[model samples]
Target: MSSDFEPILMRNVGVAKAADLQVYEARGGYQGIRKALQMSPEELIDEVKKANLRGRGGAGFPAGMKWSFLPKERKVTYLCVNADESEPPTFNNRVLMESDPHQLLEGIMIAGYATRATVAYIYMRGEFTEPFHILQRALNQAYAAGYFGKKILGSDFSMECYIHRGAGAYVCGEETGLIESLEGKRGWPRIKPPFPAVAGLFAKPTVVNNVETLCCLPHIVLRGAAWFTAIGPQGSFGPKLFCVSGPVNRPGCFEESMNITVKDLIYGSKFAQGMIGNKAVKGVFPGGLSMGVLTGDELEMRMDFDSPRKFGLLGLGTAALVVFNEDTDIRDVLLNVTRFYAMESCGQCTQCREGTGWMYKIAQRISLGAGRREDLDILVETTRNMGMMPGLSICGLPDGAAFPIRTLVEKFRAEFEQHIVRQEPGKVERVLRVLN
Candidate 1:
């Protein structure tokens, strides 16, 4: 929570007429692209590498390293900016695009230039009606200002950018699924080995980056990489925006050093400002539902990508924290997340297609006070059989579907058992040790 403030991304968020083109130029908005165009594409790549900026979408992969994966030959390169923002409790992208549309345009220009992508698209979610319109208006302004289209800024580095709206499907949040949807196909994820960097979007070399990931390029290009790296701890460079929502006193999006602990995020005055109504904090999904829950002693863990593993958890996924109060039912929580994944599964992989439905049925029954004696076994066994582990599915959706159910039943086993005990009386005690 402690650091020097620059507010590069949110600089124009609250100002009147902030989305106007002249206002953006007045606030030094597109200067990063101008500076980026002055440097060679290789230099742009190297400068970002030195900055150590990671993807903000979820994976946290090195941005420069991802760009380096593209082949050197200029054979119809493309860049796709992921503005889908489909995950629950993830509204950071929506805020950025709606408030400072030009900042994103500038970032797209720099990222497209660095990757040598002659054509780029912002794959925005269909639900983002306002953000999409704001972006389109900004794009028109940029084109009219000679910042986009044929000969951008009168330089040889030319690229055209467009916005592709997606029907509201969670699978499209995945990169390959987004590409497939962009091609006017169903939103099913494609297999890898030929990643987007080598062959993506019409079988040409491409790069897919998130809205926040592209927004950082301007700062990295304008300021030095050393300045960006100095903002956070080792392996956790740059300022990160944490979307802290749920049962908290002041739930909102907060930008802070990546080193901020989960405890601070929920309790810090500058962040969530402690739990609402002095209610006791029961559990928290530290990084959206995709990452596992933290409870009891695990609340003290730091919010960095690596620190969550100290408790046998996946790394920070989107850094979107959804908290729960002591009064909330654990069974209902399990069923809520289970149903979400089930409905959004894309139903391509056998594991996720079947596993999510099984877990949802069990959780739904348990939440409604009809839990069976052997339901615990069915839940855990179903998750394991679904191969919910990473790299098992076409995309990471199954893993997201698996983590909460696995972690909740593991960490909060007693609570889950209590549901069955209330429904089946002594039957739950019979298989309790096997579950433990």
Candidate 2:
């Protein structure tokens, strides 16, 4: 539990005392926001652009690029911080919010100033009750210090933020879905012809960013973009918080430079304990279940935005690493993830609504000892087709749910085949429990 006084989001959490307004100020916190107030909005955006910080939520879209998309005219822009960390096995955002509330608050204020957003919203997940209160307290502190509300820091610029709790739908994590929830509507994603930058909440220009993504803004402004860019691997800039779980002995979150390899992270002491039961490492879901699977041999590949791209996988989604060992069953893993998508699908898009359910049923049948050998091919083909379907889908919900299935089937075909051949009753129950 002992570690150095690293300023990474999770660095001082659980070991040293939590950072409060006084402690944060003593440690050079809020310096970014203070520095940001001195720069023009365009200058702040330019600084972020130079940092090359892509969104940390699932998609790796550039943060400054998204900000630049906002209309240049003086309209009421909005900055919505997506704190709904609902992606399965992803808990990095939660750590950031709970441990370093001031950092997030500072980031939001800076972002609001840059975007000229009159109002900001932190869309917290329903389960994040504790973090919600923590953030609420931080917001109160920020306002008390004149960091929020009218004429922030005695400048003409002004920004106000409110916390909106989601109703526990995974779809709400999608940017548009989060918007809909903020608008007091059902948490369903809206079409994107008029992207959020153009027409968003209350039909105003909005910039939706992840908690971790926004949290990095203050650091980028305080340290300069070059320093942030130079820390991580090429293209993948700044320190990344990887939430490693599953059978690892130390199943917790770690914030490290992107230079760390997947092997180093898996074996790093930051995790809960290493791998459980001395089980041989089988494979890893590098960026949660949404990104495609990586076998043990691929462990040497550095965990970065581009490294996984070479293998037809993405590194930015959720920033969660779920490791599986030899004793873990691939079928059970597929079933578990499929059911999650099936339950979370908003049913707005016919393809995602029906396809996710179909995939779940097939996975359930196979895991229940009722599947045939040919069912494997059906699962693979269904996932492939689902990935091609078109709709008003604002996010990759369909693809997120299908990518793992397709990868698992392709990489662990023999294991899936074994499930059908054995038809063990005990195995069926175990797989179902894991899926649930």
Identify the candidate with maximal TM-score.
1
User: Which candidate achieves the best lDDT against the true structure?
Assistant: 1
Q: What lDDT does model 2 reach? A: 0.82
Q: For each of the candidates, give the backbone clash count.
A: 0, 7
- Stretches off by above 4 angstroms in model 1 are 1-6, 387-391, 424-436
TM-score of 2: 0.93
Clashing residue pairs in candidate 2 are 58-317, 249-272, 249-273, 250-271, 250-272, 250-273, 251-272
Please provide, for model 2 over 190-294, each residue's C-alpha lDDT reduced to its tens digit, 9 standing for 90 to 100. Answer: 877699999988899999999999889888998899988887778888888988988888888888877767787787675445688878789988898888788
Point out the worst 10-residue segment of candidate 2 by lDDT.
Answer: 385-394
lDDT of 1 by residue, 270-310 (tens): 78999989888889998888778888567888888789778
lDDT of each: 0.85, 0.82
Quality of model 1 by C-alpha lDDT: 0.85
